[model samples]
Target: MKKLLLGSVCGLGLAAGPALAADLGVPVRAAPVAVVVPGFSWTGFYVGANAGYGGGKFDYPFNAFQRQLQAEAPAIESRLDGRLGLTSGGFILGGQLGYLYQFDNRLVAGVEADFQWSGIEGRLSGTGTLTGTGTLPGTFSLDAGSQVRWFGTLRARLGYAWDRALLYATGGLAYGQVRSHADISAANGGTPIPGLTGGVATSHTRWGWTVGAGLEYALTQNWSFKTEYLYVDLGTSNVLSSAVDDPGNGFSAGASMKVTTRFHTVRAGINYRF
Candidate 1:
């Protein structure tokens, strides 16, 4: 009887153990996952393309020429006042390459070079008869024009960067090609003077300086967009004009004139940073 009771208790304990194990749910472990963090930086080299409009002043000082002609006939100087100066505007397209460095304090600095093609030009003319006293009784006509074919600049940039955007000022050396033309003619008693007509067309390269400001924003890790404004001054150029009689009987004269160029450009561009 004692052996049978011990056997029955052992069997009951075994059945209860299985039920307890089933009541307590087992926990399963899952695979590990990756966490990603993003960082922003502006230190890099970049290349870009740009397009915009440029407009500015064309200053042609013909006072010396007017004075010379006035000495021969004072009436000619009156017609010259309204024909010497003008404004020019046109399209500009170009590309640029540059490198930049950023500081922990959010200050940024860079150097850039760019070239552009331009189609800017202007023209003006005036004509009248010298009818007053102390002047030759003759009709005179004056014409002038100026055109800028292309330009480029090497510039230094300084800015403050906020996250992915920058505000900056830039200035540096500038160079370009300019073409200028001028003409003057006189007729006395309805007959053209033999050597009293002169014209000059000059094409040359000039160097100057430029200053401006811009805003740039980074669209992605490697791409950015920008808008900028620049003021450029290409120093003066001089052209000579001469008129002489064919038979040595007409008067011989020469005029010296100077041209100063200045323009403002606004452009938008996209850049690839590396």
Candidate 2:
């Protein structure tokens, strides 16, 4: 009787152990996982568009014309002594393409090229009478104007970037198309002098240099916005206007004018990186 009782108890213990193991379920080893982190980088190619205001100075010096007139027609020297310096401002729209690289030390460098369409213009005029003894008694009128049609720049950029923002200084070559016009006419006794009317219209593409600074903010990993200011000088262009005497008359004179263009531009832009 004692052996049978012990055998039954062992059997019961074995059966309970298997049931408990089944209820607890089998052990599983989890697979390894990879963790990823995102970081910002300023190494890429970008294209962008900009819109803003541009204003500047158009300096017209009549010194050469005045000197020539002084020797040829002394009566008009006083009128020709006046110079024209006009300030012009207008809307500007443009696009840019560039590439940038960021160094480990937080230095960012890049090169960019941009083109802009502009509508900056200004006009100036004056009227006077030439009444000296040797002069043709008439009222002289002078009208002059200048316009900046378009402009462009190729620049190198250097900056310090802090995470998602960059502050930079830029300088490079600048070029632009400029148009200028001058009209000078004379009226004697309320009648216009046919042979004395002179006009000059000149269009030129001028080259010079530009310098600027800007701040750019990265809105996302692939997009950025920037605000910038640039000062540009497109150098000078020469224009000539001449008045001829009638066929038999020997008196003929020409005026040489120098038009210098310089401007300031403030702009906002959006860029996409690739």
Error of 1 at 57 (Å): 1.2
Worst 10 residues of 2 by lDDT: 63-72
Per-residue lDDT of model 2, residues 1-274, tens digit only: 9999999999999989877877899565689999887568898999999999999899988631221133455534222444688888998999999999999998999999999999888888987774544444667787889999999999999999999999999999999999999887766678765544678899999999999999999999989999999999999898654544433443344445778999999999999999
- Ten consecutive residues with minimal summed lDDT in candidate 1? 74-83
Every candidate's lDDT: 0.80, 0.83
Name the runs in model 2 displaced over 4 angstroms.
1-38, 63-79, 129-138, 186-196, 243-252
TM agreement with the true structure for every prediction:
0.76, 0.76
- Segments of candidate 1 deviating more than 4 angstroms: 1-38, 64-83, 129-137, 193-196, 243-252
lDDT by residue (1-274, candidate 1, tens digit) is: 9999999999999989867776886555679999886556778999999999998988877532221233454434222332266889999999999999998998999999999999888887887664434454577777888888999999999999998999999999999999998886766677764444678899979999999999999999999999999999999897544544233432343345668889999999999999
